[model samples]
Target: MQQKLIYILFIFASVISYGQVNLFMESDKAEYNGKDIVNLTIILELNGVDLEPQTRFQLPDLSKFTIIGSGSVTNTLIDPATNTLVTQKVSRIALEPKKKGKIKIGSVLVTVNNKIYKTEPFDVNIKDVVEKRSLATNISSEMYLNMEIEDREVYQDQPTVAVLRVYSKNMDNFRKVKDVRLPRQDNINVHPISFTKSEIDPSGAGNMASQIVAVFMVFPNEAGYVDVPSVSASVSSYSNKNKIVSNRVKLNVKKLPEGSPEYFKNAVGNFSVNVYNASKDKIEVEKPINVIIKVSGEGNLPDMYLPKIVSSPDYEVFSPKITSKVAPGTTGMKGEIFANYVVIPKKAGPISIQTEPFAFFDPASREYVDLGQKTLALNAFSHDQILESRTTVEKVNEYTNTLLETVNTPVLKTTTFKVKEKSKFHWNILLTNIAILIGLFIVYLLFKTWQKKRALVRETTSPKPLGSVAETEREIRETLKTDINDYFSYLENLKDNGDYEKFFDTLEEMDLEVRKQYLQSSSDDFRIRLESDKGSSVAEEYRNLSQRIQMEKYSPLKSAEGMEELLKAVVNLYSRISK
Candidate 1:
């Protein structure tokens, strides 16, 4: 009896381990900084049974953490002991905590073969970034970010250069740099300039140790004291890190003084002007004369204007054809402006074409200077005198009407012709009528056959009508309802197919369709209208939705929940507008 009981116990133990599944969960790190990323991996392993079609896996609640990235993979292996196939499914997620605290990850559930399995819950401690920094030696002093402006004082609409430099004492020890955020200000347009890695030098040769990381050409739209905010960059070393920041810079923009001459063309720099006539010194009346005026030097050529040439009673001056070639430079803008004038002389006399003086403010001298006046002299001849001198005389007619009345003439005889009588009706005419009737009958039969074929084709291939404009508008309105039932249907389908790009594209299309139905224009036009009407709240929401969609489509880190919330907000706004 004792031997039989021992044998039965061993058999029971073997049967229990034969067809079982295992679930395991682990984290890459037990503790993490609030800003650093942590990876969580959940794996499910099964033996002696394949995963069922109805099997499902669900991740734990991650509301307190930001999921930067997530993905899943499956693997199959053969067990040597039982020679049975084993399958493992792995799900990995990268996350960053929202705040410094003890975060709890709940149980992960897996359902397979009509059974449910779960992993135990765990806690992760997230320490504050400041605390992490205190534990290591601070090397922030060795690295710094500095911003310098070419000129602190600039005129409105003038281009100013802003250079951002990164300085480090030991380049060899620097590991990496990231999140170099630049400053942005209202009414200032920033243009980026390209640079390369070779431009950076750590050796103090001619003060070249600093790296010119970013160069921006900033243009101020309005005149006043403009304050440029500080910029920050994060740099990492072997055991320490630094958040380098530069000081703020203030710009003094002095408005152009009043009492500027009418000829002052809004030019604010050092420049020269010249005027000349391209026509002959003497010309006949009603002839056209050409005058060329050129303004060239360092200044705003695009905005500058040429002084109008006064039109007198003796001359008719048309509008000047203007052209310019301006380019940006380190010192300032440099180019030339050419104005071609066409003038007509109406009367014959000495004509004087005069131009008003051109003036511009010289920033270096801090004063306005006037370019001297220009005049062109020309002589004109009378049109009638020239025509009469070039005229040729014609000989007068010698014969009179009395001579023609004295002439005579003669007469002749006439002839007559007769017509033959008709014979009933010609056989050829009867035969022609019969042929025409037969041709008509044949054409009628062909027409009937073509009609039947066309009807059959139309029945088989014709497209359904899209209804009316009002019906389309109603459909669009229904689709963009605040409840977002239809929108979520599309979202779920796209997510299941792993097509986030198409998901964002569909949202954009919906936005456009909404704008077309209600505003009768495109999204761009709707934005303009909202801005013009001072609808700040609606405009802000629309802009935010557009920016978020664009960023999510291109960003490596994606958040499904964030996208859903944004879509809900967009749908709600559009629904309200549609109503």
Candidate 2:
């Protein structure tokens, strides 16, 4: 009976051991030599307990060394196959020994489900202060923010993008960064862009903490010299808990050149314009004529608008119907804006059309460049000439009808015939059959017409979609699973399937709460990037998204993981753009 009792006791002890949480300390050794700054990491392995998300866990505080920095909590996904949960917390600090003695780092306590768990304490030895080798500093140490272009050289109203990047040799755990001091220029617009912060992994050849990663974007503003002063950036270190600020950069802007062509308003970059008439020979006064102005080159094509044409009392004019096709990229905006005009001239002989000079400031060149215009030969027909060219005219004659139809003619009458009687059942059946046939015919015709209309609309908006926002979003999600190349393909399909109105509609429909979360300092700065008149990072981002969206047009499920990261970035951007 006593042996049985012992066995029961042993079994109960094993079960308790299995259920209890385990805590472990990670370091080279429990004890460290003098003045040695060690990275202290604490790990928790929980069994038979539910660990809630956002749970806080405390770490040991070393009496000898001061705590410098704490990292944000990171959770690792639990594998269903293992059915185990593991968590880790790390605190980094630079240690300076107060005296030569054995110092103890206290234990860390973690509470889960009202149960407290503690870890064993570790010790470090402090000896005489020896000359320690200099530790490596990050890239943020020497390299700081500077203006990519001179502040005084750029023209007012000219668009420019100032690129700011940290050229650091060693950087890790970078957090809490902010920058401001960019203002809107008079008549000029500025758009700033902030790229995602990323870390460059240490290659096997290097003995550094981290490599350099760039954060830069383009800004396209208007003409006229505008001041783009130096901007500041602040970055903090996790080890020493020290914050550092960077110097700003400047730019010089000039006004767009004058003498621009009549069709050259808002023109950017190198472009050549060609004017053509429908026919040179067969022209008539007051007859509709086609004037096709084609301007094509590299620059922001969306902002490009045609100049007005002033006409005298002899000629009537109408507004130009413009069609634009543009593709934006990291370099700048490039595309074509086609404008068609219909003009009616009163009389012929050299009607003058001014070849206005098209001017724009090139930020890349830091100078204003103008495109010279070419005039066209216009011919008009006179009214007399038009009348002489007429072939036929209608003749009118008056006549009276004779007494063939006297007053008050008798009422016309019609004759009716009687038919032989037939079987009532056969006649009723035939009429019912005819009615059913007519109904089916009508339905078929309606269905056909609807299908044709749908097809026609699809054809009209061929390259992109001008559809409902919900549908476009659905299509975008579906493309997530596609291959990289197919991702772009699917986006093209979605674009072809969507329209500009629907695009903004999707942005507007985003969850308002999600947007609020990103309204912090970093986000507020990003908003400035999106709204800058000199640049449109939002448009560039949308173009990139379009490529990504197109890649997984049909297989959104496959690209789910990649798309999640992309989507988060997009959400942040969309919020800024919406604002």
Give the candidate number with the greatest lDDT.
1
How would you encode candidate 2's per-residue C-alpha lDDT over 175-242 as one tens digit per residue?
A: 33332334344433444333333455444122433322223333435432233433444454333433
> What tens digits encode model 1's per-residue C-alpha lDDT throughout 22-137?
99788998899755667899888877555542466677889886565566898988888877778888888767566787889889887777788889999999887322111112
Score every model by TM-score.
Answer: 0.33, 0.33
lDDT of each: 0.67, 0.49
Model 1 score (lDDT):
0.67
Backbone steric clashes in candidate 2, count? 87
Error of 1 at 224 (Å): 0.8
Candidate 2 global CA lDDT score? 0.49
lDDT of 1 at 255: 70
Question: What's the CA error at residue 18 for candidate 1, in Å?
Answer: 99
